[model samples]
Target: MFWATGWKPIVLAAAMLLASASSALAEEGVPTPGDLLAERLDERLGEQEVALQAFYAARDGRPAWQETATVAALANALRTLDADGLTPQDYRPDTLVAAHRQALAEQSSPAARARFDVQTSQTLLTALRHLQRGKVDPYRIDPGWEVPIEAPPLDLAAISQAVDARRFEQAFASARPSSASYERLRASLARYRHIARQGGWPMMPPRSQSLRPGELHDDVLLLRERLAILGELEVMAAGVSAGVEPQATEPRRYDERLVAAVERFQQRHLLEVDGIVGPRTRAALNVPVVTRIDQIRVNLERARWLLHGLPDSFVLVDIAGYRIRYFRPDGDVWRSRIVVGRPYRRTPSLRSSISHLTINPTWTVPPTILREDVLPRVRRNLGYLWQQDLMVLSPSGRRLDPRDVDWWRPGNVILRQRAGPRNALGRVVLRFPNDHLVYLHDTPAQALFAREQRAFSSGCIRVQGVLELAQHLFDDTGTEAEVSTLVAAGRTRNVHLERPVPVILHYWTVHPDEEGRLVFRPDVYQRDAALLEALDASPTR
Candidate 1:
């Protein structure tokens, strides 16, 4: 709104003239026009007053938007903010363009020019800040978010200098997260936006029976069209080539080629590769293109939150996607499936370094798991303790018989499982320091890893192929033989790493796959709604 209007030319000119003359006419030093304009800018910058004042003072109170090329560069940058999943309207690009035009008009006044300068600077600074850190502070919305997003302090003086040198484009590029993942998501956003502009893909009608290969149905036409729109299907030009009849071109028939395309679609969506049009696959297909666009946008903001300042090599736990990746410095990446916490006991997002690994680890049942999970089953049957190979211990480290204790009030006593084949933490535990006390470990319940949506753990992560991951973390420190011996002997041991590897336990419902295509996962913890609400709200200064 500040850049929407201009002051009357005659009155503003007369005030400027009087203010300039007052410098010569002052008995008690009157403020000049530039000083008055600076005062106006300070008043407009509420909390940012100090930084902005320093910015202008370094330039001797001169306007930063004097150059037409600089202004045009900034305007162009603001217009393309949508590529970064930012709403251009939030930065007032239309108002900026209009005000810039008015400032360059024949009857423009100094007041109008000063307003344009202050408002344009504020808009650019806000956009840059959002691009650097994020529009929403993740902690404000989700208190359990523990990843440190310490925004780098803004050096307004340097920014002012860059603008003066007409290096606004370079400054903006430097402000954004420079990760390949971010760039891929931006490209995916553009593709999805283009899909939406073309009226999106068609939705198929509901059917009772599952559609398999060699089936003929009217809804197959919609399915073919939908898959083709998403580039998952290659529509054959109306001619047979190999192992095909002329009727294979019929849209109503679900032939072998269609089955292959369906498998590809399933793979992209992380669904079963059976190629049958079942309920889950159908639901995935019917998701509107606009909704997919928002999914990419939401993940773009997420990428902004944590993609910067990464170490050369670290482990990334993609909670929602049920996978973890180990990035090596030599551009090699190792990945495996994982089982994260369930919805009710949602795993927290955090950053910490893996300090060491515990081999043949025993499970000291956490308090919450003891109360809600173990005690209930033990109360139903006292033999549950023996079945689980758990030992009951007193507060003073003395072993107690389960039959001698009261199941109704097992106060202060600890339940620890012996290190064995049936132990909950199978053979290894990757420990990290955090208030939540969760870690990555091997699980005997490896069947859960086969699930498409693996959220079965209490809070800690159960990793598949954990031994391979531990060996990689060791980084050829010659401890592989010792680890194997200790694990085979069933002896408890802690193996400190040669150097601690950083680990980030994060949640993301959309991310790029190995091929750089976007993979949309389910919002298992229902976090997207709150974040989407915060992002859609009017931005703050």
Candidate 2:
């Protein structure tokens, strides 16, 4: 209990009246400030009462916000909650500020001061919690999403002492996400908001056919304006491609410079870099700025799920972008093109640690693939299994002849592909433990990676640089040499890593490019609507 349990700042007469009450509190046991808070919290947030009680009980009834006197320092930071794609209305800092002013003016008792402190601190804490972990539950949108359910560990004592030292703003600032990646996304979001205020990007006309160089049309002029607005083309008069003077501002020819600009836009949008405005490129051009804004918000929500406690070194597989980024202490050390699951058989978002690597791994046909992909082919052509070098295995591990089983009837037999060139698992596999049973592996169908949209796999990820990834994962030890030795032996081999590396398979459809410009990827699984719906609805359940 505080030394002056009932002492209150008041006029001389009220001060004298509190002297006897303060002495009486000392005679009896003073109710802890934590108890006073728990009493009120039990009425509003019953679930949080225990945690709040434990947090303040250790402080011996002293108020955490008593010395801070005002919350004026937190006004800007609180308002930034909206900039970070969160609703500032739900976590209003003004409420706490008003409470602090009222508590300071209270001339009733010392217990009154303590209760106000507890209530204010909890509101501040609630705001910080919502900032770090978004209000919407990932499981509600997609049950397969492996959300880290563990709440962020609270540093209540430190926060209390910091507030007591009049460092309330700095104390709560520490509670926001600490990931640089998330900060980058937030910065991009802010920049886009600025762009939105400026009337957003130029909208191009929907081209029914491909636009080629040397073509002069009104649509070409519109394309030039749009591209120039997006910073991919220089704003110049028409006929530059033909090296002729133009009387009007409208473009009269698709010059080489304009072709180069279109190519750059194509590259940025993850389309074929042919400098031609085909259907795909035209579609990318037509995506509205509002949709991109929603994409940024959706990805911001996804980022909150993993911003805390990231491994210093890890492999990030972006399923929607179909790419893998290996991050080290410095930054992204390596990257690779990848193929993820098809739209109907979407890959799950998961976080796990890479345990080991396998050389010449055999591919087991999963039940879903066996039923959907192989059975149709096997029924149409009996020699499908032989051509693919796959075999049927009985329950007792006996290799059954393909003719012995009827392809039309679903059976308990397993389809296993031998470790060879035709095997879908390819030459190497990076194994990780997760309930989804998915892993990163090399693919014999390397050509698939060159396509603009690479979601062709059943469920597992097919990496273009799996061998390079294996070499890097083994570089921590002399395992690189051992891996070479094992590959030379030409057999199925499992190589344990010197230390397991954390792997996160996530979906982020919007991220900034190297120039800090926001880049958007197609939502292959059509997931943005559901996430946007969740974000639009009240996050508080």
Candidate 3:
């Protein structure tokens, strides 16, 4: 009876529409189907209050279309839904006349209304962001989706298999390096593997008999052996975690060569490289198979997040691994092994835009350096400033008497000091506005970069290839030729940048190679443990 009652008015309205169309046909001015449909849809869904009340009432039965919570909520939903384009299923005066009455009835029923409005008002904002990003389709609704309370991206399938196997060998043998710096580990193994394949072990770098360092020979040999073990572990670990067939082709088992292999893994990871597997070494090895996978995923997400929207050129410093990479929009163009600050002077993580580059830049000893370094020296020796080639400057750039100003006075330490050849900043300063007071600059201590582990600076990054970087930044200004000329001239020259490229100093504990093999670097700042904990605790993968 109710359905029949609703159909009567709708059918009458359709008849009236047919008569009107016949008249329009006689007048030779008939509206197009698209135009007529647009008008009808707009009438049904375009008006804010009416559409909202209609949707609210449609959810349940209401006898009278009066102002009610259901109507208010439906109106809110209609207003919030992305309206770039939407269609209405019905639009006829007769149909609307009865449906409108039903909407009123629906609005009156409390049971018809939702307890809480689930439609977010930010749908328009999301669509706008997508449009700015050049998205095509605006709305994609999936009714079958269920919200996840918590999940991890780790390969649970492999982990389940690993657990099912009930063997640490499967877990350990299947592990692989998960950061960029570990590429050398793979390379080193390849070198040795090739040597072995040729039926000979590679010769170790010769240190003379006279230079026999005590307590170092066995450890060095052991470290080399450990390096080999790490390579084997990586191949095994990756294979197991990938749920691929085990590549356990090694004639020598890691357990059989445990003493030597564990040592090498420790040596490379910067843990105590003792042949014995202690708590620290075990902790390093015991990094859950899932944890490393999660770490790689997180780093990939971060790389995507940071590098996705960057300009055509930018310099990024990864602190946890103590390396800086120069990337063009095309991809990574240049990279270098960098020595970041020590634990005490840990390099900061930040976002910065490079303001300028000063070639042969003079080091202005910062107050922290002055207090921690110069002041202590001044206290030790009265002639410390002159000995170090430091010039005391007043606020006006005039040289102040080092003796006149009380070295120990808190006020005296506030003065800016001009640095000369022997200054802390060796020859250049890459300037950026950052509160960390850190920058990429030349260091007089060039030999430190040559060390295997380059975590040597205070809080700044020490570039191993500073001149190469300088050349890249000053491509337009003949800085490359100028720096070359100065070096040949055997004199230091200060050159200012014509245009500076922005440099970002960041920290990444893990990164991948071109082949997508993940490598792990030493947690130079000891950041991995905490990050690992956080990653494990995250509700989302």
Best by TM-score: 1
Worst 10 residues of 2 by lDDT: 1-10
Considering TM-score, where higher is better, how would the candidates rank from best to worst? 1, 2, 3
Off by over 4 Å in 2: 1-47, 54-60, 64-76, 93-119, 147-154, 161-172, 234-252, 328-332, 477-481, 539-541
TM-score of each: 0.87, 0.83, 0.51
Clashes of each: 0, 1, 23
* Reference-based lDDT, each prediction: 0.83, 0.75, 0.48
Predicted candidate 2 versus true structure: per-residue lDDT over 280-384, tens digit per residue: 888888787677678888888887776777777899898887889888645547888899999988889988889998898887888888888889999999898
lDDT, residue 361, candidate 3: 50
Can you give the lDDT of residue 162 in candidate 2?
Answer: 65
Instruction: List model 1 lDDT by residue over 115-220, tens digit each.
Output: 7787787788778888888899999999888999755666666777778887766777778888898999999999999999999988877888899998888878
Question: What residue runs in model 3 are displaced by over 4 Å at the alpha carbon?
Answer: 1-231, 234-283, 290-294, 297-301, 328-332, 413-421, 476-481, 486-499, 522-541
The candidate, 2 or 3, that scores higher on lDDT is: 2
Encode model 3's per-residue lDDT on 114-175: one tens digit a residue.
Answer: 11121111122122222122121111121211211111122323423443333322332232
